[model samples]
Structure formats: C-alpha cells, structure tokens
Target chain A: MDISAFVLFWAAIFTSNILLTNFLGMCSYLSVSREVESSFGLGVAVVFVLTITAALNWLVYHYILVYFGIVYLQFIVFIIVIAAFVQLLELIIERYTPALYYTLGIFLPLITVNCAIFGVSLFLVIRNYNFLQSIAFGAGSGIGWLLAILMLAAIRRKLKEKMVPLGLQGVGISLIITGIMALAFVGFSGIVQIQ
Target chain B: MFTIIIKDVTVLSAIGSLLAIIMVIAQRRLSNYGDCKIDINGKRELVIKGGNSLLSSLSDKQIFLPSACGGRGSCAACKCKVISGGGPILPTEKPLLTKAELAAGDIRLACQVKVKSDIKIEIPAGIFNIRRFNATVTEIIDYTYDTKGITFKFADGEKIDFLAGQYVQLETKPYGKVKQGVIRAYSISSKPEINSSLQLIIRYVPEGICTTWVHQHLKLGDTVSLTGPYGDFFLRDTDADIIYVAGGSGKAPIKSMLEHLAVIGCKRKMTYFFGARTTKDLYLTDEMHAFEKVFPSFEYVPVLSHSEQGDGWTGKTGFVMPYFKDAIRDPKNTEAYLCGSPGMINAVTKALIEEGIPKDKIYYDSFG
Candidate 1:
C-alpha cells in the first residue's frame, strides 16, 4: 500500500515482465507473434483491456467485495468481470476504431483468455496497492507483455527465411528465443524488486 | 467459531444475491427495447422482443442465415441486405462487404447489429425453411483415418423434411478452454425419405473446432443441436444426362442425391465420377455399387488419380476431370453436379463447360 506509483510502473515492466517473468499469457503471445503489425494491434488491445480491467477490478474488490466481506469470491468475480470487460471492449473497439479492429481481427476475442489481464488484477490485489499504484501496475504489466511480444514478432519476421532445424522449428524455436529473452530480463531484477 | 462461520456464509450469500439482483436489473433495464418487428423482403414479418442481434433474433424465430462463427463476426458468412432501419455500417462488417454490396444498402453483420427498433431486411428465401433440430447421435462409423460417418436420429416422432444435398450446422459444446458451443456446417448425407435421422460425413481437420470435437469428444446418444437444410447445392430436376463428380469427404451431398435418385427410381442416365488418391481415400464403394444395381441407367465410376499400377488398381489412371472428358464425349445435353475441393471443382467445372455443357447446366459446391 505504501509503494510509489513510479516504482510499481517500472517494476511491472522490467522486474515483473508479465509474459517473460510470469508467463501469464503465452497463448496469444505465441499465436499472434507471427506478424509485427497484428502483434502490435493485439498488444495495444491488451494494454487497453489490462489498464481498464485492473482499475475496475480493484474498485469492485475494494468497494463491493471487501465492503460486503465476500473476499473469498475474488477469483470467480475477477474472471466474470474480465470476460464482460473484454466483451464491452470489443464492442467499443469495433465501433470506434475500425482500422485497429481489422488489424487485431480474430485476435481480439482471444484476449478473454489472456491470463496477463487477470494476473495483473490478482497481483494488484495481492500487493494491496492503492488505486493509482494499481492503475500503473496494470498499464505497465500490459506494456511489458506488448514489448515482449513485439520483440518476438520482429525476431519471427526476420527468421521467416532462415532454415531452422526441423527439431527447432515453429514453437520449439519460439520457446528457446523466449528463454533467452527471459534471461536477458533477469538482469533488470537486480535493479528493482517488485515485491 | 460457529458464529464467525455463519457470519462469513451469510455475508457471502448476501453479496452473491446482491450481484444477481444487479445482473437482473441490468438485464431488464439495458436489454429491454419493447416489441420489435422484423420485416424480411416485404414477405415475412416477425414480431419479437428487441435488443439482440438480427442473426440471433432471426434464428430464435426459426429463420437461419448461414453463420459459421456463431455471430462472432469472424466468419463474415451472415450477410443480409438491410433495405432500411439497419443504421450505419459498423467497422467490423466493412472488411467482409464490398463497396457494391454497401452501395446496394447492406447495413452490417447481422451478429454485430443490434435490433433496437422495427427493421426491414432481405434474407434469402431458402433460409425460411431452416429449423434447429434436437437430434441424438445414434451411430458413429469410421470412414477413414480422418473421416467419420455420424448419424443423428431425431427425438422420438420428430423428423426434419429436408432435400438431399442440403447442409446442416452441427453444434459442439465447448471442451477444454473453449467456454461456448461452436457450430459448423456439414452437408446432410441422408436421403429425404429417411426423415427420422440425419447423416453427416465429417473429416477431421487438425485443430478444426467442430470436426475435432465430433471426431474426439462426441459420442453416441449425445444430444446435438443442428440448424438447416441450407445451401444451394442440390440436383436440378432436368431430363438431361447427369454427370456427378465428387472427391474425399465431398461425397456427402453427392451420396445423398444418389440415394435419393435410387429411392425415387429415376431412370435418367447418370455417371458418378468419384476421385481418390488410393483405396484408403475411397469410401462407400459398396453403397455406390448398390446404387448401380438399383438404377439400371446409373453407373458408378471410382477413378484413382494417383494409383500405382502394381497396387492392383484397374480404375481410370488420371485426374477425374480428364477421365470425365474421355468418358463424356458429348456434354451438350448433360447436367453436371460437381462437389469437391475448390481446385477440383474449378478445374472440372471449366472442363465441363468447355466440353459443351451449358454454363447453366453445371452446378457446383466447393469445399474450401
């Protein structure tokens, strides 16, 4: 509760990279990283959903669940909230941002199952962060996921022509690359401890 | 301790009740739009409660438009012409529709479009007969490594009156991470007279939603949801000689039509050119041979396109269409019903038309 918003933000990105650190949303990260443009679109959508849902979930937990003394139901409540939020976000995005919707296309609905969004909310609750800290944590965690996927997408684009070994092709090579990236991000943990 | 536990339980129940009440309130307040009338092509009118998508609203009223993605707007298959009251086209539907289609006043994806008011739309006349049947899977027989013949019997005394060569959407309950039921279309292989049951020949495409479910998770005696007798692929009632061509799992509707012809005892001369790569790829050979016995003028031609001579194969050795060219010297008086992969259908259709079969005489259904 005493954590500064800036530290929470930076820590969420580097020390607690959602994709690399927690492996919270590997499904879409693996599927959508084939193209930079589509990955970027999905990344942006995830950022939007994470930021909003984190804040919304925090409010629902604190104001409703905590006030009513039903904190044990957080898991079920969080999932429902996330699903509904994703649906509403899809409607709004499809209505207002047609180009983004086209770029995201089929990847938009896949966000409902993207664990990073729920993970962010659960992390905020576990950390017992204030509203501003929760928002920063959510937005930063999403940005962290986006950054990791975009980097992977760029590597995939470059490696498209390269003849990967049969054993290391497709998901095999992707996991190896992700492992290296995870190691690289480990250096940032020395500078900041999110916990 | 008991008091604390009771307090906790009571509080949890109270919160749950409150949330349920809120959801109910939201449903009544947010979803209500009074009674809405949907006028289709100035012919049929449906009066129903509003605030749902036109696709689902129409489906609820027993009018089924072909939608592969279950109103997710991903398939873009459910396009209807909204002559009026459709409002502005949303961005989601723009990619699927053409400028000409938009100019012709097509409004939006029926799934994406909410019917808040009385609306007038034009759906194809064929959709009127589409009904959702509650059928139980009575039999499942393996046709090939990837393909299976699934037969669904109607609930006692319930039967669907559908023509041969029409397709029905099979619904599969979500398994694993999939949380909702997904529906996919399969051409009905059963003849119309066999009204008590429906048969579908499903080939499992790896990672394919419905087919994978049907192949792996589906079982006999399980209730399945189906909507149809949809699609424009059916035998044309003409006196001309019929050339029926099909390959792989594309044999469903073709089989249906053949069974139908046998049942009706039609005496018109017909040749069914079934193409396969090997013996394993071919199925229902006995059924086709049985039809040959029943329909004296009908012949069953199973052509192996890539069969090795040493494999003890005596069938025609070439692509089915070229063999068809040699078989049908004069197609001017022939009506061709072609069903198969897109490549096969396109190549065969072109060859048939070039061989003097009138363009109008050739009907095809392409499986992408």
Candidate 2:
C-alpha cells in the first residue's frame, strides 16, 4: 500500500496505462485522434481535467464518504464531484485563457463524462493512494492517454495520403492501428509494478 | 438498519447541497463578463451587460438581426461585421463563413460571438427600423388543407411602413404540452397599403412547435407579439419584365409584390407561375384571376404537377422549371422573383441562369 509517487507516475503511463493498457477512454481516443491539432487540444484538456478532478475527488472521498462510512456511494459521489469541478474549471478557463479557450473550449463539455477521469479517481480510492500518489496517477494516466492519441493521430495523418485498402479505410484502419499500439505498449508492463 | 439508511441519505444530501451551493457561487462570480460597450458603425454606442451572445445583445438594444434559427447559429442569417474587439471567430462560426470572409477578418456569426469585452460591429442601417408590435388576430382563412392566412390588426392604431416583400417574426405563447414560447418568421402576404393590418400565410409543418401552435391552439381575437419587416426579398423598382415563380406558402411575399404592382398600376409585362401538386393544393386562384383581369399587362398561369384525370386540370403540367424555360422569352430584360422550398428554388434559379437571366436579377427566398 506504500506506493512511491515516482513509481505510480511511471506505472500509470506505461505499465497500467489508462488508454493503451487499460483501454479506458477509447471513444475520444479513436474519434478525436484523427487530426494532430484537434488531438493535441483534446489531450491537453483531458490532462488538465483529470489531474484536478483526481485531487478534488480524493479530498471528497476521505473527508465526506470515508468519514461517514458511506464508501458504497463513492461511484455516484465521485461522478458528481468530477462533473461540477469540470464545469467550474470551464468557466474559469473561458474567462482567463482566451487563447486556449478557443482551441480546447469546445471539448471541455466532452471531458465531464470521460470515463478515464472517473477511472483514475476510482483506482486511486481502490488502491488506497495517498494525496501525492493520487495526483501523480491522475496526471500520469492523462499524459499516457494524450501520448497514445497523439501518436495515433500522427500515423493517421500519414495514412491519409497512402492508399488504404477498400474495406479498411476510416474507422476500420484506425482501430487496427490502435490495437497494434496497445500491443506495443504491453512491452512496458514490468517496468514499474503498480501493485 | 433503518437509522443507518437515514444517516446515509442525510450525508449524501449534505454533500450534494454543498457542491450545489459552491457551483452557484462560482457561476455568479466567474460567468459575469461585466458591462460591455458596443460601438455601432462608429455612430452609436450601446452599453449593456455582456454575459450573452452578440446577437442577443444587439436584440436587447432594439436592433433586430434577421435570424431564422433565433440565435442558434444554424441559420447563419445573424452575421455582422465585427470590426474590432469581438475576439477570434469561434469554431461554430467557421463552417458558416466563406474562406474570403474569414481572411477578411470582418465577418462573424453574431449568435456565436460572446460579448466578453467592448466590441465594434457594423450592421445594416435598416435593422434599426425593426420594432416589436402587439397585435390581435382579426381573422384566419384556410388557404389550403394545411395552410392558413392569418391576419393581424395592430392593437394600437398604428400603421406599419414596409416594403412589398418582407417578413415579420410572430411570437407564440406557450400552450398545450409546450412550455416555452418560440418565434417564427412569416412573410407578409399583403402589400404595404394594407397598413394597419398584416396578413401572413403559414403552412402547418408536422410537429413543428410554432406552426402546430398556430394551427391547433391559436384562436381568433387572441393577442400575439410580433416584430417587424425583416428580409431583403422584395420587388426591385425597375421597369423590367417580371417573372414570378412560387409554390405552397412561398406565394406570400410574391403575392405582396404583385398586389403592390397592381396598386401602383405599373404596366410592365408580368408572368406569374404558381406550382402545386394537385388542384386541391391550389388556393387564391380567383384572386389571381381578378388581378389578371384588371391588369392587362399581367398573366396568371397555374401549374399542377400531380394532377389526376378526374381532376380535369387543363394547365401546364410537370415541374415549374419547364414552364419557366418556355415562358421566359426575354431573359435579358427579365427579372425573376422566386420563393419556395430549397429544392424548388434551386431548380428555378438554375433554369433562370440557363435562360440568360443575370444572377443579380434573380431574387429568391428559400425556406430551409
């Protein structure tokens, strides 16, 4: 249970990666990963939302759910906390970061229901991660998802010019590419043992 | 066990309420964009609270922009020149703007642009004249099985000055199962001389919010709210030969133009072609015939595309394009006015272009 922050960070990205290994948040990973610019924007938004929601949910879980011994209600409680936190972050970003607001603004709403953020919070609670470990896990998982999507997007952009087969053009080819990337990511499994 | 359930409910509710209160406070503090000053054409300045869209802001100032989708950004009709301080064009606006317009850095969709700061925008001078009026439904005439010609008299003894072919937005109150009021643009079917009274011909669209309300729930002697005289679809002041093509409720603005011509006693040669699916689908035939009788220069031709033998229809049959191709003899000196669904208008516009009518000479209003 005494997981180091350094090991948790690397393990979340590589060994137990949120997208490539765990296969969570594949919907946006497949759809938004078609273009590099849009993929970049969505990746940054996911990372930002995931890290903050993870820390916020950790506090909520300990101070409220665990304090009252209502740990069974963590799922619904965590979701509500994540959604409200994302909304607040959106309003603040829209006010301050006008540049990033234009690029990543539209995808802010999409990040609320992103199962990857929920997965991070749930995993942090289940694994009994301390505050630092939870934050590291959250940021690492988000960066892992971002990296996977960016790689796939770059390959897809290249694949656009090359002639794909008749049957495997759009989503068919993209899914195949993702599968191959997932297999490649399995090579990083034993680098850092999370459990 | 029962006491444990109560405690669980109490704790969850407490957490939920705490989050809700926090959200309320954050929304109030963060979403407030403060009061913004909008410079209109370098002549007028409007200072208003600025958390909403530029379209709604302009509307609050009584400067109405023509938006068929009512600021939903689907219509793209509420576009204006954002001269400065409007910030970058949004992703919602990119698809609606042309490459040239985007590069020019002046045009933007008013509905998508938030007024977060002081901005300078240029709108058409005519938008200032649009005024909201309270009116009472004096009569509703069934023009077809699905269409009604509803006439509204100004609740105040005020006359509206408008062009021959323009539209007004009719605001519907919530009725029946519907809970929200909506505004729909309907063309004025009568000429400007009608003055204190305005008539709109509306076709019932299946399950449409405003149309269903108008057809099923609206009663005569009921008071309604309306805003005036929007659109560029109108008769040009020229002596050129006129060719008018219309179908269904598209006949509204065209009828207004023809009546205005008749009232002015203009002697230009005019050919009016009205298309319908069958004889039963046609209305105002007697009135059009009467206009032809009084104005020797005008001719009325009703075309039915789906007429049956029992109907005994003796008129040009098939789509209006063929009849238009045959009737348009002097395309060089002819101006064609078209109002219809997008399909019909596109066909007619194509035919007009093929027949040598200048693109600028072809005026049309196509309902999406």
**lDDT for each residue of candidate 2 in A1-195, tens digit (9 for 90 to 100):** 787898888888888889877778877777787779879878988888889889999998999888999999999899889888888888888887655676667667778888899999999998999999999999999999899899999999999899999899878998899889889988988676785
Q: Which stretches of candidate 1 lie over 4 Å from their true place?
A: A1-195, B1-34, B98-100
TM-score for the first chain of model 1? 0.96
In candidate 1, the residue pairs with backbone N, CA or C atoms under 3 Å apart (3 or more residues apart, or in different chains) clash, namely: none
- Local distance difference test, each candidate: 0.84, 0.88
lDDT of 1 by residue, A1-195 (tens): 777999888888999899998988998999889889888889988998999999989998999789867788898788777877676666555545645655675777789878888889898899899999999999999899999999999999999999999999888899999999999999899987876
TM-score of each: 0.62, 0.89
TM-score of predicted structure 2: 0.89
- lDDT digits (tens) for residues B195-221 of candidate 1: 889899999888887887899899998
Q: In lDDT terms, how accurate is model 2?
A: 0.88
Number of the top TM-score candidate: 2
lDDT for residue A140 in candidate 1, whole number 0-100: 93
